[model samples]
Target: MTPEEKYELFDRFCSNELSATEKETLTKLIRENESIAKELKLYQELNSHLDTRFTSEKEEEALENNLKAIGNSHFNRKATTKETKMIRMPAWAYAAAASVAIIFGVYFFGQSSPTYNDFANIPELSITERGNTEKNSKNAEYAFNSKDYAEAEKHLLILLSKDKNNTEYQFYYGLSLLEQDKYVATTRVFEKLYQGNSGYKYKALWFEALNQLKQKKYDQCAALLKNIPEDAEDYLRAQELLKKM
Candidate 1:
């Protein structure tokens, strides 16, 4: 997309004027293009600065000066706090860009299973004791990040055998199975996590939803996504994916 087109989408996003489909498309576009991401970040920061540009007190002078400084860094045009009118845009939460479309094609335009590439942001492995450099830990970290799920599963099993109560190991083990399309094994792992009281309980539900989504089981996916409360870290992304699905 052209810079102008991207800015238009960015404006619509700030104003909450885009449809859910448009939002998803714009989001995917921004993620796939670094230039667009940078542009959007600059726009949001500019919008945030402009929101506080006009203030009436002497202490407000610092804020106004800060806005000028930001504009100097990010904008090509000149700006003064004394400018008579302020540009206003509707404010909304900026959905994080850490979300990647793991699927091959954008879901906004098609009726296909979401892929592991689009949604999963596998956490970095720091499984062993901080001072320990075990072979299983090193191998698991490398295998998982390299998308070698089979290798990851082998090492993870070794790690889990030694640390049976490690929920983090169990969690990544499930993800490894899921990535390898071991649906039955993956379900077993996540189901155990979902039933336990670990910090990963809610996250297990989110991953199960992704599992269902990858299988095109929209009803099951929707149900799992709905079970996630607003306080969960994945809640916002779950809602966005739910809408697209």
Candidate 2:
């Protein structure tokens, strides 16, 4: 119902003639809008004034009824004015509304999306390139390249146990953890790699950014991406991702 209809119900309530539905609607409006509650209080006081000041019961009743009708008429006029304002909205109006809604949805969902899968370009780890011919290193390489992250993480752990300072092993191990959604472990490994001065410094920053992206930490991701210099391998990709964000 319109505000006019609601005011009509409120007037009927003041006149001691509220139906069950009008009472419920009035109660709900009072709970929902403080303005309605204040207005209702004033309306009740006006009714009280009509009852107390008038000596003749019939005269009091007629005056109260007219006052209530005037209140109803005032709100009805406002409702009529509102009705006049609402013409048929165009198709483009709906399209514009949809576009606004889509933009709104993106402003929200974009905070969560354009994620790790959207930008991760993790290269296949090669144990032979670093001259580690150990069985576990070979296993880690094969498993990681084949996207078997669970097995890769297990084998990389064994390899890292023997050679703790091998940054290549650590970077790939971080990748394995990240691929398996081991976010905390991935960040730990990547943090060490990023902090150290090695071939993996910028690379570590890039992957850490991807790790942040996976967790929907766009600000952190952007921070890490910005640290990548133009000469860095992932610099172009990071800039592109920033634009999307």
Q: Pick the candidate with the highest TM-score.
A: 2
Clashes of 2: 0
Q: What is the per-residue lDDT of model 1 for residues 39-102, given as tens digits with 9 covering 90 to 100?
A: 7889988977776664445668877999999878665443444352474433431222223343
Per-residue CA lDDT of model 2 for 89-132, tens digit only, reads: 89999899899999999887865458777688879787866676
* Candidate 2: segments with Cα more than 4 A from true spot: 1-112, 129-132
Per-candidate TM-score against the hidden true structure: 0.53, 0.55
Candidate 1 TM-score over all chains jointly = 0.53
Q: How many backbone collisions does model 1 have?
A: 6
Q: How accurate locally, in lDDT, is each candidate?
A: 0.81, 0.88
Name the 10 consecutive residues with the lowest summed lDDT in model 2.
110-119
Q: What's the C-alpha lDDT at position 65 in model 1?
A: 94
